[model samples]
Target chain A: MLWACLRFPQLAFDALRGTLPNTPGAFAVVAGPAQRRGIVFANAAARGAGVRAGQAIATAQALCPHLCLLARDPAAEQQALGAFATLAWRYSSDIHLREPDAVLLEVGASLKLFDGWPALERRLRDEIARSGFACRIAAAPTACAAQVLTFAHDGIALTTTAVLQGALAQLPLAQGGLESATVTALHGMGLRTLGDLFRLPRAELARRTGPAALLHLDRLRGHLAEACPRWQPPARFARRLEFESAAHSTTALAFPLQRLLRELELFLLARDGGVQHFVLVLGHERGASTRVAVGLLAPQRDAAHLLELARVRLERIALPAPVYSLALQVDELPPLTPPHRDLFDTRAQGGLDWPALAERLRARLGDGALHGLACVADHRPTHAWRHTPLDPAAPATRDATAPAPTANRPFWLLPQPLVLRTAPQRILAGPERIESGWWDAHDQRRDYYVVELRGGQRAWAFTEAGSRQHWTLHGWFA
Target chain B: MFTSTADLFALDSLPASTAWPVAAPATTPASAPASVPAARNTAALDTVLRHPGIWRRRAPGTSALATQPSGHAALDALLPGGGWPRGALCELLVEHDGLGECSLLLPTLAALTQARRRVVLVAPPYVPYAPALAAAGVDLRHVVQIDAAHTDTHWTAEQCLRSGCCGAVLDWLPRSDYRELRRLQLAAESSGTLGFVFRPLAAADQASPCALRLRITTAMNGTQFELLKCRGRLGGATSLRLRA
Candidate 1:
């Protein structure tokens, strides 16, 4: 199941460049030699104003007085890439994240589920439309060609190694993130195209271009195999969306759905969260509606997964008599901490990483995941207790199993009170004394005692000395 | 001698449901009365939010002046509760024609004019005791009455509650709608004024929002009042059988 990949030459940069085109401006993102805070990226706008890579700060600034300078924020780029990775992860878990900006995922596993090759293309087109930039996808039998093609301006340019080699023949050597010195050396030797370099004999090329460039060349021409690692969902966080009205038109339903799905990034970012299951509900005009839900092999809450499951399922389903509302409910929250089956695995942002877990579940499952149990004291077993929605803004639970103290707990606590057969329970214990309500007749003083023995099971009992011969059992541990 | 441990028993966990505990007589078990206060009428759903305010406060600039517009006035002057204390609660009892309920409320309203305070009426569904109130000398011209049909109870109650300048607030509503009046009663208390509530026939002398709860019925010449509840100091709910 080969899915197509279409690339839009340099649209992201183009968009950035277009922001101030024709007005002497330059842009570049400088990665600090090796640190995240380093100057790693700058726009073409900043560049036009005369800023250059590797130049000292004073020189870069002097060259372009009006340059819009910014320090590299790896976290921001990582988040952006991370969000896209989750989105792409939905198409296929087999994903390779080329940090700072790009990623590649194997969509073969999802092609059929998403309606096969051509439909997948149209679906991607329909989905990514107005998504800010054009993304090119290319699927082939090999990862080498696929990876290279994923970077091509058009879908077919990188489809075959022969065409890739042919195209590479005229391509400049520096385009592959190569050093300028290497490019100069290659250019001086008349080694321009990748194919031209390849024609120079392996040993010579390795000696001249070095292992980095050779490996790049080999990977580009489909001569080697490299795998893209799969992405993991956030650990915790709940995400749910409420629609203003029941969605009657399937085509128009993406509005609210998209906004809700967008929380996937924010929730996951808050804590290392991820989702494993998702529950989508198409709320009806009244209260009753349809539920279309599914679970994934791995946990994930990225918008891509939600959209894939929803889009595919919805395409086949007939909108239920014009839905008046729709809601996506997610649950089964987890924590950002790695499987801590062991005692140690330092975790952070704060302790007990349930927020990330909740975010993940919220992302994948909708907002319904991650519930906290609240006990309600009632004699009726059916009304004994329930799960209350936990507040995200509150502190995360270190251990959900432990009880959290609330304001004033009930004094006369009952896990479950007994159903009296007659006279409410004979006093086995008693006359212990509870006295109040002096001014009103409604007040009385009683002594509670314990009693036992028709068959020897003890029970709590209270007797009213000031009133009728009332003797009643109030509790029983057994 | 029963041992202290004798009265001890293990309790199974359960959910807690609460109710105003005043309905049960001291000698009687509260099994049925416990269910009386949770009245939320789902049948006439429209009246859910339109519920009138069961509570009120004294308008500004009136030194020691309060009003209780009982749909009647002459009856307002003779009452000892003194035309309903401001930021306080007055509970009414109704049978057919509310059993002279209109006549009993007159003096309560008349006493307010002892200073000329404006009265605010909310979502009143029944007819007023016009001639009776006029006879009692209540200044009907100083009244601002709003009538709504089957409204959302909370919204209506909230509107009247936030309107602090109204001298008094009155509403005729069923008790089962909610234990809501207590909340409004608390609001009136905080604002320092009076609230006269004509409750439905469910609770005769139950715990409610008012500092004092009265059960009034109409007699031949006037009305009869039984003090079902009193929360003020030196005051306590006594079944004071009174005829005015």
Candidate 2:
């Protein structure tokens, strides 16, 4: 198996840069704000001024008077790592996150699909660059050796067992991620390079150190395989962002909501799916949560479209209280079907873009504002049809056995039949009787006829045949 | 050269400069032809034949404009360019709400809906009888109804038309101003949707910006259609009949 390891040496600094647009000066990411705070990461400019990692905050400030310090945000670092893992997953399914800064990918199975090692490496480099991360990539026969080489070199691919062993032999024994005491002992014993340590007898190394050192060496050299749990995408997308200050208005929430949506878009794109239903929960300071559910007629993954829909829905809502946190959850993710386009036709036709327009209208006008017409198989004119919510899954078509309309059905049917006081001047057509509806409530028995009024207007009027001889105007004919 | 007032004003003594019409650029070599004609017979016959407004001799009722048949031959013949004018408003004025107005437009709506294009009905007087629409061959899935109040009726209709997703939008406006109608017309023209507005017959006396306006009234045998305005024909001259 071949493994590629990508190490982010300046994860703390890069995380800040990825989140904010314009960050000035050479700042160090400190571990904490209290008594235990120390510089965990420093940029090149800060290093030039004598500030380095593992230095006390006071000592760093004394060395570089203008050094800006920022507290390390573990949440942001974890989010950034998740985003990178999603990017790696596009090329290979077997990927593991090496914490604080690296992603390990088992790419042996994906080499053929990406046209072998050279092309795959090139693609990985280009995609990482596009994602705005500075990574040092190295490949080896095992994940452990690849991770170690990524820290010291750039783009080193050791494919076969001989090449891996040769590359590992050239590395200094200090770079094997051993404790400082062990490295010092090795140095005192005059073992500098990994080759020197390997040349020693196995019994002698165990006598010098313990069996843990030997096991670590074996795992690094591919002699022993360790279980590297593969990262799986979460079944549903649920990301929460805590605001520094409570957001009092919807406009204030847009920025953070946009970041969450961008992440969701990347997540969906990696899985080749689209979201149909999602909910936005606003957490209030008083422990109450306001949830806004946004549903689309079609599955959509476009960030701008989803944001626009969210904005419209948010406008109509009255916030219960100031929100301290916001969470986005999506439960329904349907596979996206690419729209079919006619090769010969070049016009921007109305096949795919209409759903976006419908979604936009729905967002503004509110839910239940848009619906399609459906015909029920009832004999009563008022009970004949109903309004159905529009669905994108079902294409527009009529069932073959859908009841064929009679020739004389009126276009307009009154909700309640208007009682006719006077009789008609001329009888134009039928005394057709529609006497159904004994099964359900509101039974009706009447003799319906088409008669013309004195103004030469034809009307569909029905007369009760039971107790009362009352005439009612049911509808109008063309 | 003589230095005198006469030398400056004398036509014969002064050197002639190149005139504006015949002046040639120094960079452009004299080898190239001069004075290319501004006007040329660049109109191709194929494009002319494809133009929607132009009439062709091959067919009697065919024009270049794409048309959805009205499902009534008599009404189709009465309309200019053979069928309903696309991307323009067709105003149908009636005395009352339910005087066969919906029936007149149902055929066209069904045809558009059947073709998988959306047909939105905005602010109808009553619920659309779905059984009747389905029976008329309309794809029920594509027929959307927007419930808008009187204040938001025009705005909703304009938005639906401007979306370009709907093949047709039918709006029943109880009262509308001339400006609103013009805006609706412009939206329809820009989005390429077939627009139909049902207005009161009293508004028919006022001039409209619609492409086609017909006064529909109940006649002896059936519904009568009087063409009030057409794109390329004289208005109020033709009357067509449809069976009841």
Candidate 3:
């Protein structure tokens, strides 16, 4: 099987570049504790000024007076590697990530589908370049061999096993994936290349260099049946970004928050999914993370719409403290369903994008401000209906084919039935007795009638079960 | 070219394939074969217009104003468009806040709700009693009420109308000037949604940009629908009585 290896040699610096602001001067990634730190990666400008990896920070800065130093973050580097593996998974299902740097993908099954090696290689190079990473890519018969060859050349696609072995023989042992100690020991034994090492007796080499060296040689030559752990994408998505400076106000956070949302949009688009609920966590220096959970009436994946909803939600919140980092987590991702549009609309904008507008309004106005009315099966006026939250996913309980109310009903019912002293001028309809709602604690029995008052206003009035001949105004026809 | 008046009468005697009022192509009259077929097609079109089975042009005095049926035949006749004029303002001037105004608009609003069109109520004076509206065949799931600030009432109404997200917007703006009403009229026209502005009865004398103005008053027997102002028809002369 043919395997493709993508080696990102400077991931320590490249991973942090996306989160930081674009600066003019060069920067180098420093590793280890504060007291014993050294430069691990440098930009072109830093390298041109005589800065090299594994040198003390003080020595490197003395050599290049204008060099900037940034502390390396291992968590961000891991996340970036996972993102690269996810991108590579689009081309091949079988993928294994070599931590801190590279990805190995089995591309033998994908060659014909992607229109052969050259086209697939061009696409991979273009996409990786667009993602802001410098990669050294190589394809060989085995995963380990492909990775080892990637360090020797920028782009190499050797298909046959004979050509792969021939290319490996010429590559220097220093460039192969081996510990510095192993390479030094091999050089002490007068072995300069894989060709020199291959001619030695296997048992003698194993007795001298131990099992790790022999395993390495076996894996490189496709003789070892090693089990490489395949990478699986996590069901939930969580991304974090630490800002250069703390954002004290909502306006200041908008730019970085927008960038986080754009990344999430691309993530969901690649998965062919949509999120209905997500939480934005703002990490503050002194207090706990403040979480803003943004929900939608329907699942959405569009970045612009999600940003607009987040903007409205942000307007209503007061920042508890200055935030230095932001984490976006999406726990619920449902498959996206196509939006329903009116069939006969000829307008430039299709007939009423209602679901999107509803979500926007709900975000601006709290959930308490929006509700849907539902009818309950009760004879009493007040107990007959209830308000339900506006959720599009909830199945509708009110049947459209249900029978209508038999008695005459007014459009508006008074909140509290007012006691009346006098009778009306005329009675338009007869008394309708309603005696239900016995199961619930609040029960009522009354006779309702539609009448016109003396001052020429139509109203609905009811009299109690016991004889209090005085009429009570319950509602208006309006 | 049939410049002379007598030459027009000679078209009836010409061959059926020739067009009416033939042009005088004197120089190359015999060699023009293409014009013969083109003229014959015009003649065939004329024959189609004269056919008894076809309806040639609409009859005069038949109104063509687009309307949404008010669901009441007698009220539809009183309306200028034979129903409620859509995409225009309809002002309901009430003597009192509860003088059967909701009853008058319940039918139209219910139809819109059942059609899956959203009905928005902006700053309603009281909580919309759910049971009553549900009993009247109004789908409650499609109803949305906005309790906006007094300063934002007009702005909210205008936005809801302009958004095209609502099939009808019922705003209770008891006090508004000419400019505010005009903005709402334009918003309704642009979005093609019905905008109903409920105002006090005292505003009847003030001129409005609404297409239909109704003054509802309660009477001893029933309710009165007084057509105070209609866009293209005389007002105050036509009134209807309904048993509320």
CAPRI band for model 1: incorrect
lDDT of each: 0.50, 0.79, 0.79
Query: Fraction of true inter-chain Cα contacts (below 8 Å) kept per model?
Result: 0.00, 0.57, 0.47
Residues A281-383 of candidate 2: C-alpha lDDT, one tens digit per residue: 9999777899999988888898988998998888879888999999999987799886554587422344325677678778877677888777776677777
Global CA lDDT computed for model 1: 0.50
Tens digits of lDDT, candidate 1, A190-246: 776555776788998889878987887676665776555556755443344555555
Off by over 4 Å in 2: A12-39, A42-71, A112-134, A201-204, A238-260, A280-292, A314-329, A344-352, A395-404, A424-439, A465-468, B1-66, B113-117, B220-222, B234-237, B241-244
Better of 1 and 2 by TM-score: 2
Model 3's chain B yields a TM-score of: 0.73
How far out, in Å, is residue B45 in model 1? 28
Off by over 4 Å in 1: A1-44, A47-63, A115-165, A168-170, A176-181, A237-262, A265-478, B1-174, B177-244
Per-residue lDDT for A413-449 in model 3, tens only?
A: 7777788889877777858777876787787888888
Q: Which 10 consecutive residues of model 3 chain A have the lowest summed lDDT?
A: A345-354
Which candidate do you rate higher for DockQ, 2 or 3? 3
